[model samples]
Target: MILDAISSAAGTSSAAKDRAGIADNFDTFLQILTTQLKNQNPLEPLDTNEFTAQLVQFSQVEQQIKQNENLEAITQLAAATAATNAVSFVGKRVSVSTTQSELTNGTANWQYSAAKDADAAKFTIRDSAGKVVWTGERDISKGDNNFTWDGRDAGGLKLTDGNYTLSVSAKDADGETVTVGIAAEAIIDGVDFSGEEPLLLAGDTTIPMSSVKRIHNQ
Candidate 1:
């Protein structure tokens, strides 16, 4: 994806090669025109106007190829800048809009916001296998609410430490669905450059740079 993004920004994969081929062909054309002029009868010289126009056409093509090269350079520089900026995020904590969370040290935390006052909010915790291991209700307010789970299942039995997901469903007093947004916080362990954009490695979860809502100090 990263390569695709870069290539898309620069134009095409064969852009440089195409430009080189165009330059070589133009040089050969110029040589052929020069030879034809030298061999033409001086009594009726080859039409200079036609050759002049051909030269202009070749110049235009060369200019366009140069412009494309400049654009490709700019695109490469921008990608490098993004990667450099992403390096600073390492070791810092960030809040990302994601459903997955890591259960470390026997706990996991998340923050959710309610659009309106919800009479009731149900929280469901699912393992990586998509099995609902825990389900409970949380007393939520109209705005922001924080939730914490102690790595325990519905039966109060401790679960193994790993990655899990939290989902919240809320309803207003009218029983209509209440819009909710969920977010998870984690420390940026590293940056993954294997994608179109840098991915923040937060424990076992990979969060895209665009998904980060906020960054916090460690």
Candidate 2:
């Protein structure tokens, strides 16, 4: 059932793109026909059926394009409404399987795992300037382990609330470096649809729908 829904969405997106392409082609064809008529010799005129057939094809394509655009508009409106409903998540704490914590209300959480039992593990939070604001060592299990940051630097200064990248490194018993990854969950303060695509605004970070693994509340 999940696969079916994904396939349906892909098909719809593709159809919209194809419809836009057809509309563009139709416009180009109309321009060419107008130019041809203007440049045609007065004595030797263009063929009637040829011009009529082209015009008919253009009209048919135009209608199809309009229908496709209407369908797309409906889909966009539905998506926008659904996204707007997600705004209720604001001020509520939730978890999502994602990387890059979108800081909200000066708090964010992430989870990571070790491929093997790490002898040592460290969580490092970096600002946009590539400076490490916070770092801590914690014992972690082989599976997912959650970490939280209060948007503070090592000097105990409260950092301005914003998105920050996290890096984790672990060493196995044999002293081999282990790779660690993180995913953060945030409160959806609002929805952004200023552009052609919709995004979920979790604080300063605008996350795309494609990046959203799951909606927490619903």
Best by lDDT: 1
RMSD of each: 7.2, 12.2
Q: Write the per-residue lDDT of candidate 2 for residues 1-218, one digit (tens) a residue.
A: 22233335445444446556555555666676678789999999878787677667657766877897898899878877766665655555455445577566798678676676776587888877777889988767787677888988888898886668888888887888886756677667777767766667766777666655545653
- Best candidate according to TM-score: 1
Model 1: worst 10 consecutive residues (lDDT sum): 1-10
Whole-model Cα lDDT of every candidate shown, in order? 0.82, 0.70
Task: Please state the error at residue 67 of candidate 1 in Å.
Answer: 1.8
Residue 161 accuracy (lDDT) in model 1: 90
Q: In model 2, which residue pairs have backbone atoms overlapping below 3 Å?
A: 98-183, 99-183
State model 1's lDDT.
0.82
